[model samples]
Target: MTLIDPRNRYPRPPFKTQPQDFPGLSANMGPEPDYGLDSYQSGERLKGLVALITGGDSGIGRAVAIAYAKEGADIALAYLDAEEKDAQNIASSIEAIGRRCLLLPGDIRKKTVCVDWIDETVKKLGGIDILVNNAAFQHPRKDLLDIEDEEWRCHFDTNIHGMFYLTKAALPHLKPGASIINTSSVNTRTPMSILIPYSMTKAAIANFTVSLAGSLVEKGIRVNSVLPGPIWTPFIATGMPAEQHESFGSQAPMGRPGQPAELAGAYVYLADPNNTYTTGALLPVHGGMPQL
Candidate 1:
């Protein structure tokens, strides 16, 4: 399908058609074809499972939601109110795959909202088999002293605090074989000069994953984290400066940014019941970011 921006004066190309080939086109492109349309195919790995994912409206969350649907699991999607349209679209896509999708719009930053979201997911889906704590926000700061206390608090509230709230609320419903997958960042390892608060939260998420996994092991619940290096998502355009967005993900060893589709497989594997031995593990999907 051809996705043209309404504001653009020129015609947009079809999905999966390379941008390089259409030099004359000057439109604000839609989602990369690989993430949105081309690369996602159902695999039924999580048949009969139920999953609740925060930020399942767009980007990595949307990719994971579609993947989970394809894997034969029902999804309860939670996102901020601003993303309701995107979340509904993803719900429609999940339904097209013969899976049920429930959309819950709220801010994960509020403890009460987090509790309610988890409660609603359990009520709608019966019980949670996979809990994905993936909602996050970041504000870039160039100077360390320029960072305000409010921004620091907001970072913790959105990234780490929300995860804690949702996890605590869902723990009661998550059964012996349930899995919790948190999204960390490559910036946690290779700190970015501009995103101190964001990177700190990601590092804390890594630690939280480890501690949660250890605590849940006796109960048979698994917790693991995925550290994504540089994936091209709406966050890049909305969170970073225009110059950074123009060349986002280009610095990776792969010489290109990752599409959301590429990370969905990892989430499926971690969430699958068949693989029960792994927990408290950190999987780095950073286009070959060094390990040492």
Candidate 2:
């Protein structure tokens, strides 16, 4: 078995395909993304806590959910029907770790789904202490004019709007020590032309994290956002045309695509209840990708 080194530069060979080729299934990606089953260990830092993770079917979301389970937290996973296969596997893995996994499958674009997911989480897992707003939609376009009005609007609905809906619904159940982690991106600082809509939402997420952190301080709720660089996920495999996949992470300073497992640490650290003083922080897991 080849031991994967987190520090080495990774080269993703060229691949070309039609857009949205893989949809939500990471398992079917040419080089299956690692969800960190072998690389991570349990510290039980989140014992007795309950979390609701959006897009928990695969990639970083899956990694975070599994890590949280290892830390002794029960999970409520939100995902799309297209991701059901991977979602089921994630659920089973969480259960195998001796924690309950509640699978809530639906589009976050719908306000009702967001509300219902939180309600179901509280009902099943007792209460939510961690809310990971990790679900997002990104479609790369070569030109600004190529983006359609409907697609642009959908990005906001799925990315930022859903976060708002869920956070509002979860507030009542959240205690003073709860932590909310939103998935921002390196593009928040350096916008990529291909991902204009996605970048816009991420910047908004970072802004929301800071603004919300200040507002929630009185309630002792901490809010933060994570900025991920080029990490190998289903997004790289299928979001854009196949030709773009060859050098996906080559642009990062580290010259490699980070595995989903790399971001797991930041997610857990930000959610650490004992680390109470940390809030409104933008934790970057970007393989040395310069923020500026």
Candidate 3:
């Protein structure tokens, strides 16, 4: 067995300044975010289950989708039409692993899109055993007044509202022993001044996760959130200023950013039926970043 030091496992500071437009594609990212295409090994932990993951085209969502598929779960990926290339690539990877993959491309900000995707996943992939509310929007503004009204609404609409819509839509189809995982951020606790809107939504997501967990426990549904710190993904490439890209994950004590591959195991553990007692938990996958 080989032991790897977590601190230096992934790329560190001085990242290339390759910024893209909003909703950036991982394909264009320098040192492209790793979505477990090669490193993750399957344990067949979630065999024969079905999962619906928003933003499954790239970054953290892509990692989770691939990990779930490797664990023997059929996947339904929901992403934007603009991210079709990334989505298609992930779908192919999942299919290559001998798992079924369904692609639903649309904006999650619309309630109709959220509901339709759930229905389609049920109709096509059997049923939803895991619902991952991972799609989100973020834009940094140094001044609160500089955050436009539309931008503020966009943050909440894409983050919390979409999660609410998707969860409500997926609940009925999710039977006992189902898992609902939301992608929250460490900013919920250590809010970034410039990321006011995005950080606020993350805080709300954490609360929603805990509250939903209590409400669903009696039904045998597990609800939880994964709070990630500064992970190297397209979020940084597009959301922050080009100058900030160089030191992206340098703030973390680990001195490096986490790759999506690093967080895949956490989702797998939460979705495993054998881990029945672990619910309403906020699993922190930050690299030595203290959440509280």
Candidate 4:
């Protein structure tokens, strides 16, 4: 196999300061995030499986959905209604690959929405073998004093509560050999002071993954998390403060932000049924950023 240099493989940061409303669209991003549309190679690692991914219309979720579809898995994407255009783009690509793609548009913060999406996936896709809790919400504040109760609750509702609701609703459909992958972050270890609420939710996700893994092991279900570092996603372009954009990922030891495509393989690995022994792992793909 050929190797690509990690540092210079994708676009480096010093990015343009382009901000958008909450839940930004990747298509609007300058130097749009590479979701492996033309790059990732597929080996059918997840063939004959159905996977549901929240936030699957863009960023890391988009990359993972594309990768999984390429690998022969039917995909179900759960994203916000505002991201219709982005969701449609992904659905078209998956359909072109001859795999089924289900677009579920709703706010995952609501338990009803979560349950509906899970039920829809099972009804349409037959069954779900992989569950990816990747949708998240984060708004940075310069100081904790500036953070409001609603802002803090928004982070928890979307990031942590949504995961819980979706996972609980999916539990019935997730049989033996099913894989549950949550999108945690390097913030779990090194909480960013400015993103207190977001960081706290991430830490909770890490603990949730481990505890849930243990709880599901008896049923032959496996749970794990992918803790990504400074990835070049719409989240960076919109969720962060404008002043931070230019040096968005400069703090990483590699001197660059990681592309969403770069994290696809980690998700695939954890979901691959062949790796039965691995569970409750918090795999970090942070461009050599020190999480400790």
Model 2: residues with Cα > 4 Å off, grouped in runs? 1-5, 9-19
User: What's the lDDT for candidate 2?
Assistant: 0.88
For candidate 1, report its TM-score.
Answer: 0.88
- Candidate 2 per-residue lDDT, tens place, 228-287, comes to 998888877666556767767777767778888778989999999999999999988887
lDDT tens digits by residue: candidate 3, 1-292: 5788886777888888988998899989889988987888889999999999999999899999999999999999999999999999999999999999999999999999999999999999888999999999999998988989999999999999999999999988989999999999999899999999999999999999999999999999999899998888888888998999998888788898899999989999999999999999988988888766
Q: What's the count of clashing pairs in each model shown? A: 0, 3, 0, 0
C-alpha lDDT values of all predictions: 0.80, 0.88, 0.92, 0.93
Off by over 4 Å in 3: none
RMSD from true fold, candidate 3: 0.9
Task: Rank all candidate structures by their lDDT, best first, as comma-separated numbers.
Answer: 4, 3, 2, 1
TM-scores for the candidates: 0.88, 0.95, 0.98, 0.98
Report the poorest 10 consecutive residues by lDDT, candidate 1.
Answer: 18-27
Judged by lDDT against the true structure, how good is candidate 4?
Answer: 0.93
Q: Is candidate 1 or candidate 4 better by lDDT?
A: 4
Per-residue error at 60 for model 2, in Å? 1.0
> What C-alpha lDDT, on a 0 to 100 scale, does residue 169 get in candidate 2?
97
